[model samples]
Target chain A: MNQPIAHASLAPATPFRTAADARRAIRSGAWTGHTVGLAPANVQGNLMILPADLAGDFLRFCQANPKPCPLLGVSEPGSRRLPALGLDLDLATDAPGYRVFEHGELTAEVPDLEAIWRDDFVTFVIGCSFSFEEALLAAGVPLRHVAEGRNVAMYTTAIPTTAAGPFHGPLVVSMRPMKAADAIRAIQITGRLPAVHGAPVHIGDPSLIGIADIAAPDFGDPVAILPDEMPVFWACGVTPQAVAMAAKPALCVTHAPGLMLITDLLNRDLAFV
Target chain B: MNQPIAHASLAPATPFRTAADARRAIRSGAWTGHTVGLAPANVQGNLMILPADLAGDFLRFCQANPKPCPLLGVSEPGSRRLPALGLDLDLATDAPGYRVFEHGELTAEVPDLEAIWRDDFVTFVIGCSFSFEEALLAAGVPLRHVAEGRNVAMYTTAIPTTAAGPFHGPLVVSMRPMKAADAIRAIQITGRLPAVHGAPVHIGDPSLIGIADIAAPDFGDPVAILPDEMPVFWACGVTPQAVAMAAKPALCVTHAPGLMLITDLLNRDLAFV
Candidate 1:
């Protein structure tokens, strides 16, 4: 999961203390790296931009599978600003990096979407697990992937997501191995934040969910599952991207994996309480 | 787990619709049976009345172990009424049945505490799992024991409770067998009711918590566990009674298992939201 050392020079000299600061840095081209540890207190969202023609069905798909695609805010067609997320935030440029998909195939990776921005584009900000991860870490529950500096292991499960139009596929889940006690605490802590993939989707035996091997994952780097720990699975934000890709949309733009759009909303604000 | 058929003759022809009605029925000589399923929409509490001298330490014990001994309301010494629980409820007679314990040994079973009420007694109303069970059932999560017409299986665990003065012992947990999906839903539903036992303390394996057999329980009748289900355990309110018994208070009083004090508070009122 180690990043290329050559890219270290583009990393920010100091970590961002707020979502606004992080977005400013990304917009100014000072930070072009993954947003994992940056703006730790604010919500970082999964970005998905599609044409207005496909927006209705995709919105229904999100409503059908809220655990994986909890819609935080949706932008009006062709609008760059999502005032609810940030007053001056530009959906096309706020994310550090963006993946351009042409007919469901990754055609290009761009630092900013200015050249490809379209008038009929609609932006959908989906809540990511990072919000609840911050909550769990704040409560002293250790996340193995975060501690080891690796991407959380994600898998494709046999569990079918509720379909809407062409958006229908198997659910994707992120795994975090923890002791039984921590797993229970994680459930309680994350259960409070329904916007961010609330609670665990499955626990204990991974085979029940159709994962053939515990050591290998379909997405992200695999981390160690200690002898005493159980792998706890949460519905992943990757589900929307995967399902959208399977449908072969003519044009779809998403934040690259590990690179998210930092929003001004605080993580605590996302908690249902 | 069946109660004597003779007791059915003493039960009300129709179940009480509210806590006030149930308490009134118990106060009168019309109801002398277990309070399960009676006043189902309200909070049912485990009653614990101890001497005034021991009240301080007992309160601390409950505060330290809120999961197992969630303190709902504490009465002023010698006070028969708890206005917060119910405006006209009498601690001495609201419960359907009570067990008189002298020096930690069960001496006699009585319908009410009027004959043995003490001037220096302090009634401690502890939250019970029945509140969360109601929430689970309302959410369409089926509870095996409730469906089978049996007691929820309970086991004494290797997990120990934090000590406060003389009160200290192993944590007792109530087990509910559920399929993976229902167990996940149950955790989220029950997690919202922290005033009750809250989310599960442990899940998946029983032996890990020192239980030798899943079929045989330390207390309450063992209900059938389906082959596809896992036993999910929650911190049982029985922990307080067990800890108090180990302390051997000179005179202690408690509601007999399954016979709880119905409180005026609605189950929805206890949700953390």
Candidate 2:
């Protein structure tokens, strides 16, 4: 989970309300710290802005591996808003932070996208694990990361993604410790929300996916694991960014890892059935 | 898909009609065969009838594992009708065949229960995997078992069911061969219908659940497997019948495997969302 900034004077009543208001505040540069726990119930997503040239591959990538890169919204080329996600969404500056890349190289960290707003930029909103995390929380599934106030332990697995042009790399997974019964029920509950990483990709043995160490993670912080619990892993949204970076695009922009775009779309809207 | 059992006497258009129509045909000995792939899209279920003394334990066993043995309808003690499944559902004579077990032993394979319908018999209609299979077929997921026109491969796993009196045994799983793409879609599609062994229990590696061989199943014939596919397993309805037979009630009876009770209820009615 992303650590959100505490703005005592501006915090909203509830987590959901706080998210909507927080995004609005971030759009205006009032609060640009982080959007992790701010709007807890609402669907928060990772952003990938690229020219129309690269979007086709990214779209294919998201469509191919929907579990990790579940697409919530895809803006028209040169458009600044994705009406499906939020009626008043401004893709360029709605997120709390942005990382600009030129030729896949890190260039600048901007609070807002006022300077590099490109007419050719197309914004793609991919579903993150946070939406399902919220769903799990609502269903009374104990989340070790949230309980311990630590980011989920994310590992780069050897399982390769379905190739979509230049977007192809090893799949990324986030680990969560859970009892067998809770794991089964969590699969049933999260299985309802296809847009939120859906059900876990792999369960039981971590070695099956090529994770050498359970205690160490490629990204995020490691939480505690009890004796009776199995570490469940879900495909992550960073997969596309990692794939895109490896692809070496001429120009790429994305939200900072922890600073996701909070959308007005209710998490419940993600359930297919 | 298995060849539809089209009776010449009945309207050829209605694949499998009312239980009365089926039983009337069966009683006259017009049609005596497997009921599966007979009723097309209608709900086909497992049938169980035990003496009144052992009804409570059997009911508890069904309740314990709703996935494998979801109780669609249960009859009053000494009654042969299940009003919930069908208005004129006569459990004593509806199914084409019945397996009679006495003292945990197979005593006879009969055409009807009229001669042996005990006054204290309690009939229970348990949900079969047929409902979800219909949904999967409707969703355009190519079923390998159905394509090969064979019974779904079922295996007994090391995973044990919650003990309810004397009825307890390892969980039984039905296998379906599917590629990653179809497997994911199958997960989402089947997850909607919880009454039909919703989703899958173990996917990818079969040995992880203690099944030494995927091809050689304990029950049901094996189907063809593709190189790009994984063997997706589901909690099979046979788990209850097998366990009940193992427990060896004083007088126990069940529908012949593959020949189930056809109910009037639509498969979609069982969907949670």
Local distance difference test scores for all models: 0.84, 0.77
Clash number for each model? 0, 0
Which one is best on lDDT?
Answer: 1
TM-score against truth, every candidate = 0.91, 0.75
True contacts kept of 2: 0.06
Candidate 1: segments with Cα more than 4 A from true spot: A1-14, B1-14
Candidate 2 structure quality by residue, lDDT tens digits, B1-273: 011111111111344466456656655657777766566557777888998888898899888888788888889999987787777777888788888888778778898999998889988888877778878888888887676666678888988999888889989888888765566567767767777777688776677688998878887776777766667788988788778878877788888766678887778778852
Q: What TM-score, to 2 decimals, does candidate 1 have?
A: 0.91
True contacts kept of each: 0.69, 0.06
Clashes of 1: 0
For each candidate, report its DockQ versus the true two-chain complex. 0.61, 0.15
TM-score of chain B of 2: 0.90
Task: Tell me the tens digit of each residue's lDDT in model 1 across A86-157.
Answer: 998999999989988888888888999999999999999999887888788889999877766667788889
Q: After superposition, how far is residue B88 of candidate 1 from its true place, in Å?
A: 2.8
